[model samples]
Target chain A: MKNTRIRVLIAKPGLDGHDRGAKVIARALRDAGMEVIYTGLRQTPEQIVESAIQEDVNVIGLSILSGAHMYLFPKIIKLLKDKKVTDILVIAGGIIPPEDIAELKKMGIKEIFTPGTDTKEIVEFIKTNVNTI
Target chain B: MDYQEKKRIEEAKKQWENRILNKVLPQFPERKEKFVTGSNQEVNRLYDPLDLEDFDYLADLSFPGDYPYTRGVQPTMYRGKLWTMRQYAGFGDAEESNKRYKYLLKNGQTGLSIAFDLPTQIGYDSDHPMSHGEVGKVGVAIDTLQDMEILFDGIPLDKVSTSMTINAPAAILLAMYIAVAEKQGISKTELNGTIQNDILKEYVARGTYIFPPLPSMRLITDIFDYCSQELPKWNTISISGYHIREAGATAIQEIAFTLANGIAYVDAAVKKGLDLDKFAPRLSFFFNAHNDLFEEIAKFRAARRLWAKIMKERFGAKDPKSMMLRFHTQTAGCTLTAQQPDNNIVRVAIQALAAVLGGTQSLHTNSRDEALSLPSQESVRIALRTQQIIAYESGITETVDPMAGSYYLEKMTKDMEKAAMDYIIQIDKLGGAPKAIEKGFIQREIQNSAYQYQKDIEDKKRIIVGVNQFRSEEEPMKDLLKVNPEIEKRQVRKLDEVKKKRKEKEVQEKLKLLREIASSEQNIMPPILDCVRSYATLGEICDQLRAVFGEYKESIKI
Candidate 1:
């Protein structure tokens, strides 16, 4: 019944506990009339991918500030591809250096949002790119 | 001035606002409809004598080192001795961080503050599957006492005062430190240092928790008992508001929540039949210094005065040292911007100056390139030099609280105290900090404030120098410090070697004893020390406790 609205999973995909930006974006997405499921701190990439598939969410927004994006983001994307769950729009935000964004995008992360990104931009990106499966 | 003179000034100020100001307002107006502090508290255009008509100087702010300690903790303040210049630095493997420590100490740094990596902080060995990408990422990785020994290889424990920023595994790390000191042929009594053992903020903000709150508090009280008996100079717990502020708490919430947690620790220790005066003197605090110069200064002053009163009135402490709220301050990391990263140096300088003006006991100025990556050697050197410049070159340290009697500062300090106290009263009604955090009251409040802060920035209500205003195109920063992925492989391999070299029989026996002590009502510190002395890994010891005290499952609320 809620299929008309976009569903998003705001996941904290690493050991980093800096969740202020993640929570803010979650609330903003919720206020923008989307359903947001926030996976709290210390979640592994496997848990994130499983939740994305289980919830049938339209997007998986990964947030990590612990400098583990180079290792963790690829694993999550690989897991989604292995499961053939390609419809989920993958995005990330945190302390990602600019040098890593190209490889991350090539690995299937749709976009990489760094620090100081406005939440409105994230919301618009998700709404425009969400693929209804 | 008398009451009549005060009345005349008040009337003249009102007339000036209405008559002269009204005429000029038609052509030009204020930049914003209202100005607010960093915490969103409204700031008036000006503060004068009219604001402090009922202010009592003697009772409210006694002399330095006197009751209430509103002026400063020491009698002469920085005139007697400059504050300790401690830079918090750690990354990569133990060898890498050891070199950084030696580098810092050689460059006029007075103290060492250790930062542990995520795996070390969350009680996982570097080889643990969950710690694959995280080893030696955020901070240094320590798998066993061997790693700790390598961390302080040449550093003399008796000479240098160290502060370890570890919480969930604090006792294990502290025990390793003690073992390292013993190996150095130094007595435990001579070791002067502190451990960030405060765990309440973990549930609210930092989230490096392993055991649940009940068992975690017991471990904290055990450390209190052990340190008071053995290491008298070692500060047991540094009740911290630094992470809470960085997690988007307003300044008022920062002090209120931090002090509330402090009260809870005291209550737990007293409930365990410990003397308040014995541990209270060693109970230090840690706070953040943000860009709001006057507000941050007032926050520190109000925090000190409020803690003094809380000890005297609430806890009935008799020792003057027990009542003093000694604290360490770090310039706010959350305030730094990634764009035009060099501008962060000026931001750090202003924040550092505010900490000095507010009477911080020790200070850490953040590096300029931190917002982009881990600071390079050059950036950290500049950060340490920033503190040195304030201590030796700036004459502000020559006086004790030079901004003490300013009308605006006094009124703001008083108002901050009242507001923060109101928050404490609310937390008390919810049965103190742990209960408040359990019910998700504190987290929700911080989240709301955090969301509002982000909204303000996005809406252009707040102007960040290089982020939202005065924009400029810049090239990518060069020489950013990157932790080598090879460090992880090398660390895990070393951990394996240590595991093979240690006596397995003694490790099992010590871990067994630790489990027995943890399950029983006895203090767990002694057994933990035995485990560390036996070269039991951090993960091995924490896993034993996790078997007894279940891991904390965070209730997700966003």
Candidate 2:
């Protein structure tokens, strides 16, 4: 079985149907020779967590634009904790405000990427931070 | 000029090109080998009469308010009445948003366009766990008829035209609007507004859909028949290109895909045995006015002409109003930059000018602070004043189709129409908009364009004044409007109060009737009105229908 490439999952976890950034990152990650999975719009946290566990992805990236990250991100983090999927590096990107970044980081998010962040930076961050199995 | 004069000019041009230009071109080489528009339309360095030597004025460029309206729709246009100054505003709770609406009206807004939060847009009440932190975040949280009543508390139904930006549950929101009007002692016939019931675009661009495609069409056609019979003044569907453009479709794809969706909606209605002439006049459009000024203006002109031909040639409708493509234009939100907040005001002003020059029937200028969050009060006021300044001060509104005879504009308009027509033909070959969307054709085109646009920005080939090429150090922005977090808790408590107080039996009976109507072929609007009047929550009504018409799960191939 093949197991060398870093597996990353990019998903939109809210009701806002903004998939441009999510799809961009998914393409970028795939171009970087990583296995990337994209869960389309309006996915609940439960669906995201279940997909993550089934795919056994190394990293999970969320793209939230609807300003519900305070509730949604933490809920996903708690679900991962309950499921004991702590090895997965979690990151976020979107229209997140500057004030919420620290709180999101404190909730076990490895990083917060806001608008204007380059996708090359995202690919590098995953390569360095996430431990490849 | 005469043929002799033209020959001399051409000979002079050839001599200059050979002698001076050829030598100078090597020393100062052209920056790039090719130039293109946002939609990948090739652009020449210059345009002249030779570009449109075969242009037809009477056949191709008809007068305003005539058949095949390549110009503006109305005869007198802004001279008779200025385009409606509608600033789309709604945030926090209903009472808070109501205050904003009143403030906007006081500031000379001619119409009200409500923006609902994601939960309300997707047909959920405030207390649902899915709506926990999103109750009133992006837009106002609308749960029950009570919330809607509070939204238009002091606004009279007969006085102002309202547009609600809701798609999946557009039928429910329309019922709530009519129910609120009834309480205000206004008849359904007196109510004038529009519901954005275009669902095909949801599958194409956004994801605010509840039911799947077939049942969603049923909901839309039910509104078409019901509103045609009862609320005669209401616009049934606003087939929108705004979201499609925002999702990064080029101007040509925006026109083609949106019109393709319009064709599908009309086909669905006609198949249901509805008269095209009766409902086609009320089928308005919404388009995005982006940064490319002349291109956007040409796009609007092209859209009107294309739709006019579609109505007359395809649908064979006889009513003049049926053929005219009346539309609302919103300044593009994707063009705004978070780098410099105040620069957005200037961007909005330019885009608004394009829409005005393009003869949009209505316009919304987005606020400067929208890229960060909901705009502050001052920011919104400035945005409204942007529209006001264009309508009152800008002399561009005096003459209709001022850019009509310009060689550049006419050629570009024809080119955009041709390109968009090609796309419509392709989608038509694939069985229409719905089947094309199911196959991800439209979505993939938008995604590819979006990727190219982003790549251009990152590579600095396309210069965003604040974002890509020119960035500077700045202090962090302050006083940006943040929705109060406690609004969620209070909204949930209010939803609980309604669920506890409303007559449970009446709500159940109405919901059951809605279920039966949804399951069968009967129109779903009357039972929906009964449910809303009985104080059934938005979630309860949508849930009852969702059980019959299952929720839509997209095929994610990205």
Candidate 3:
């Protein structure tokens, strides 16, 4: 009861096939004693939101490297909202430009990790940022 | 003379080691007891003539343009003509990407390299929900021949060589290209370019794969056979290791896995009763130019020599061109760091230099800001200039295989080649690359390597300047090229308009015909081209094939 494993669903939402970061984060989370479900590349926002809900994941991490985060993240957030799952923590990573970071945060992505992000820092952020419903 | 020279080399090495032990080693301890190459091949502190004791000039390092082209595939190399500086450019809708392509060509880019959006790459119309937000995001969106026509609007298909970095849906894209060329009054025979038609890497490294392996290989062989007769000028497949390396393969693994995939393609074509010489001669390769200078140069040289041997010995191909391993190099995208983004320019310059020194046939230098977002036009221009400056300014291009006879380079080349061949042999034992991929062997190997590399960086074993070391506080890169948010809407509207205008009956007939031939023992190209001519969308054509081949579910555990 004291050390419940946190469940995380990681999905790549968009066209970019660069998944080294996502896989690394998945490994880091799993190594941190969390359950990580890595749905491999090219998942639609609908598929990701559905997967997150199906897996009952506490954290949904989406990696988009193709500069589609502006179009993609908000869509994912909207779908999550439509599903009435507001308590689930949604964090996004990949090549999101500095100016767009604020825009992404405004769309309800709890945290956005940029390049050179330490996985430990991400784990810490997730541990602290998970919604306490 | 050999014995005396070897003795002298050994004595000189001993003296150097003695000095290092006394002065340098005592003052500064070595970084490790043993140093390994990126491939984990153990390396000696000093390489000398003794290391190349059995190295035969003709047998090993053949003259350029000769058998086992260790020196280079081209005799003059860059001297006769500089390697085609094909900057891989595409982002947003076809119109925007077209402007970029024309700008690149006008600014001295020798050819066009089209990067299709996700849906385009994986065989989906822009209107599909699976394609939402991704249409024209990473690359140009092409749902029909209409988009292809717009993409190459004024660009002559016959004159300018184009490379499409789309796999899985390569055949569909190729069909569209041929259709577009036909509309331009260009015959298929006169067109020249490459389709990164190598789909095996899609399953192994890149995750854009759609169909299963057997069908994918069939599609690749279809292109090989079709291009031999129809598009004689076209280089059929750019068997690629660029994605493999970016996916975190070591230099040796990249070479091994890529050439392994090449071997699989060759075998597949041969099994289909296609003459190896006819198709193998057109087989080109795409490699990644990573930050390791010596390793990358060695990788290129070794890949050429090994491929030549594989063709000549394994496949028994007599045509000299069939044995040659001509490759295009793109500077490693994985090495680019968003932190201190300006530093990526230097990183790309070094990697591009390695590719040039390694004797690339064509090269694409990545933009520095690419690690952050789609490169701003300024970043793309600078990326192009990096290639130009290297060609015009770097004196290294003055000589062929400038690093050919380096004691270190020669040893590393042989070592890398040997290690790669060992992996190939292991894969061969596992029933080849496809089987190896199915067994999750190659993917697991890459994942392990990727994990090790990341751990190395995190543990301070490797220093990535901007990220792990030499830390600096800087404002994030701003004004980065962002994809027009409304691109998906525009693309979907265009897709809808095309669908609405096209004859529904004809589209259905073509799609049905495609479904039939896709499962049968016939070349799927003609039917696919028919689908293209009928203005059947990429998703429709692929949907037909998907119904037969079934989508491949990745078995990779990680």
lDDT of 1 by residue, B1-558 (tens): 588998899999999989998899889988889999988999998889888887888877889989889899999999999999999999999999999999999999999999999999999999998898999989999999999999999999999999999999999999999999999999999999899999999999998999999999999999999999999999999999999999899999999999999999999999999999998999999999999999999999999999999999999999999999999999999988888999999999999999999999989999988877789999999999999988889899998999988898999999999999999999999999999999999999999999999999988998888877888999988889889989999999999999999999999999999999899999999999999999999999999999999999999888
What's the TM-score of chain B for every model shown? Answer: 0.98, 0.97, 0.97
What are the candidates' C-alpha RMSDs?
1.5, 2.1, 1.9
Question: Per-residue lDDT tens digits of candidate 2, residues B1-558?
Answer: 457766776888789789998999989988888887766677887777666766788777889989888888888888889999998888889999999999999989999999999999998888887787788988999889999999999999899999999999999999999999999999999888788899999987877999999999989988999888998899999999999998889999999999999999999999999998988888999999999888999999999999998999999999999999999999999888777889999999999998998999999999997777778999999999998888888888888878898888989998998989999999999999999999999999998998888778777777788776678897767788888999998888888898899999989999999999888999999999999999998999999989999999899877
**Sorted by lDDT, highest first, which candidate order results?**
1, 2, 3
Top candidate by TM-score: 1
TM-score for candidate 2 (chain B): 0.97
**Per-chain TM-score (chain B), model 3:** 0.97
Pick by DockQ: which candidate is best?
1
Per-residue accuracy of model 3 over B374-412 as CA lDDT, tens digit each: 788899889999999999998988889889889899988
DockQ of each: 0.78, 0.66, 0.67
Most accurate candidate by lDDT: 1
Task: State every prediction's TM-score relative to the real structure.
Answer: 0.98, 0.96, 0.96
Of the pair 2 and 3, which is ahead by DockQ? 3
